[model samples]
Target: MKKNMGNADRIIRVIIAAIIAALYYTNVITGTLGIVLLVLAGVFVLTSLISFCPLYAPFGIKTCPMKKG
Candidate 1:
């Protein structure tokens, strides 16, 4: 798959995932909602690392800049 995420997008996702993880670990978030967020956080990290978002593919959205020929 092509990279559809730019540096800013990747950074933001990583930050969000880190926040979610911190909240869960600190007990600031708990139960079902915490679990759900934790899972979403994992997805965020995965997508950021891979630089691709499956959801964005169908919509034709791309945050990555075009390469010069």
Candidate 2:
């Protein structure tokens, strides 16, 4: 799939995921809500790593710079 996430977007996702992970591990967030957030964080990391966001596709959103033809 084409990359829809730019460098800044990817960095922001990673940072957010890290924060969620930290909260989960530190017991600041617990139980079902924490589990759900942790799962979301995993998704964020996965998307950032691939530079692609599936949800953005349907909405036609792209953060990456367009290539010159």
TM-score (all chains, Cα) for each model = 0.97, 0.97
Which residue pairs come into collision in candidate 1?
Answer: none
List clash counts for every candidate, in order.
0, 0
In model 1, state the lDDT of residue 25.
99
CA lDDT of every candidate: 0.99, 0.99
Candidate 1: worst-modelled 10 consecutive residues by lDDT? 58-67
**Per-residue lDDT of 1-69 in model 1, one digit per residue for the tens?**
999999999999999999999999999999999999999999999999999999999999999999999
RMSD per prediction, one decimal?
0.5, 0.5
Clashing pairs in 2: none
- Candidate 2 yields a Cα-based lDDT of 0.99
lDDT of 1 at 56: 97
* Angstrom error at residue 35, model 1: 0.4
